[model samples]
Each structure stands twice: as C-alpha cells, then as structure tokens.
Target: MKSYEYIEEVKRANGLDTDYKVAKLLGCGQNKITQYRAGQTMDNETARQIAEILDIPVWQIIADMESERQKDPSKKKAWKMLAKLSKQAGAATYNLLILNSIISFLVIYYAL
Candidate 1:
C-alpha cells in the first residue's frame, strides 16, 4: 500500500479522523503525515509505530515501507511478498490459538 493509504488505514483502525490526530498518536508532526500522503516513504521507526497503532506485526509494516522505497524491481517484489507472508502468518497464529483452546476444552470435557 502507498504511504497515504497506509496512513488512512491507521486512522480508520485507530479511530483517528484526521492527520493531526494520527501524528499525535504516532508522535510525529502533522506535516509528516502530510508528507506521507504526498508520497513520502516512511522510515523504519515510523513504520514500527504504525504497526503498533494497527496492532500488526512490525515486520509487515517495515517490509511495506521498504517495498515502497525500493528501486530494484526484484527487491521490491520480495519485500511485498514478505509483507504478504507476514500477514498470513499472523492470521495462522490466531487460528492456531483458537484451535488450541478448542482442543484444551475438549480434553477437559473428556477428562470429566
């Protein structure tokens, strides 16, 4: 996703209605958000903060920002793939937790 789109997603996910609010949440200046909207690629620290705000894995955001900044097509593609895989991994982890809970419940029920 582009920086602007990413910022918008952050806003939506965190209930922030404006750039200023997002900046405050991220501990950045509003101009930084504006710069992102205008196509400025975010640094790693900013990406990390965004991940925290969105409750997502930091690597995913880092990869996304790197993909946006990368000039080499191959490297950019790799970064995009990394971001996609990380998202999938996060989902799988959630599913695994749910499955583990179900199994634990089943074991306890059978034990009784």
Candidate 2:
C-alpha cells in the first residue's frame, strides 16, 4: 500500500471502519484525522496510540512509516535498521523485565 493508504489499511486491520471513530477514540479532531489519513508524520506518542488502535506492535508502526516513505534512500535505510533493532531489543528487554519480575516473585515466595 502507498503512504497515504497505510493508516487506512491498519485501521481496517484493526477492524476500525473510519477515521471519525479513531478520532473519537484518540480524543482528536477531524483535522488531526485528516493529517493521519494524509499520512503526515507523527511523534512517538501519536505513533504508539495509533499502534494501540491498530492492535499492532510499535515496530509495525515504524515499519509502516518506513514502507510508506521509501523515496529517501538514506532515511529509509536508517529507519529500517532502527526499526529492526528496536523490534529485537525492545521485545527482548520487555520479556527480560517480565521474566525478572516473575523470578523475583518466585524467589520471595520460596523464601517466605
């Protein structure tokens, strides 16, 4: 899909039918909706919120961004690498934190 259409596709992927519904959920307005649908860039918070709405990992959001804007070779390559690294590191870090917490809990329980 093209840059302008990725959001719509993700929206459909998430079972959301329209930008209005997303806007309501996002607490934004039609202009902001237009920006999203127009494929304008957004910050990380907005990206994460959109990912939440799209029910995809944030890396997928970064991929969507990279996929849409492939004209700039350097930027695209950089973001692609960043996204790939972020996917690996982010998931590993998250899982490790969870595992560490569980291990800590188990240790405390056993000690008690």
Candidate 3:
C-alpha cells in the first residue's frame, strides 16, 4: 500500500529486524531509511542500490517507486522523465559495451 509498508514487508520477508539494518545493508544513512519509511521520492540510483542490497531485481524497487509516484499524481511527469532517461542511459551503456567488444576483437584479429 505505502512505501513504508512495502519496505517493512520486504524486511520481514528477508528476516531483517529493522529498517536500520536495511539501510545499513544498502550503505545509506538511517535518514534515508526513514525517508523510505515515510514515503519519499527515491531516485533511480537509490532504488537500484536498495534492490541490490535486498537481493531483488532493481525493477522491483523501481516499481515500488513508480507506485508511490503514481499515488502523488503531481509526480507523474517527473517520474516518467526519469524512467525514460534511465532507459536511454542503459541503452547507451549497452551500445558502448558492444562497440568496445567489437574494437577489441578487431584490434586482436588485425594484430594476429
């Protein structure tokens, strides 16, 4: 239902005793955990890091963030923009890795 509720659910699901433990595992401050508990707008990076710490897919965290954003209504545009940017960045990174692999292959092939 709410952000805090979701976090608490996950925390319990993973056998964690407190949100502070989750925050510490995430390498973030307890204030950040409090914000999560209070329902705050978490950026993509924070969501990703939290997901990693929680041993779940990053999309799950993003989905929770998206759900919270949708509830706010006013956050719709901003959330969409960030999602688009994250997608584009992921694509660009994939393309860069492919290009690098191709260059590396070519360099080795030509040298041999």
Best by TM-score: 1
Task: Report, for every candidate in turn, its global Cα lDDT versus the true structure.
Answer: 0.88, 0.68, 0.69
Candidate 2: segments with Cα more than 4 A from true spot = 1-17, 43-45, 51-70
Candidate 1 vs candidate 3: which has greater lDDT? 1
Tens-digit lDDT track for model 3 on 1-112? Answer: 3457656755776789987887776677889879876768677887776556555556655755785668566585566566556656666777898999999999999999
Report the C-alpha lDDT of model 2 over 1-112, residue by residue, as the tens digit.
2333645655676677887776676677867768865767655566677667654467756675764567888878777777677667767877898999999999999999
TM-score comparison, 1 vs 2, better candidate: 1
Q: Give lDDT: candidate 3, residue 93.
A: 71
Model 1 scores a TM of 0.86
Candidate 1's C-alpha lDDT? 0.88
Clashes of 2: 0
Q: Give Cα distance to truth, residue 97, candidate 1, Å.
A: 1.8
Better model by TM-score: candidate 2 vs candidate 3: 2
Question: Alpha-carbon error at 14 in model 2, in Å?
Answer: 8.3
Q: Provide the TM-score for each candidate, comma-separated.
A: 0.86, 0.60, 0.49
Best by lDDT: 1
| lDDT score of residue 47 within candidate 2 | 69
Clashing residue pairs for model 2: none
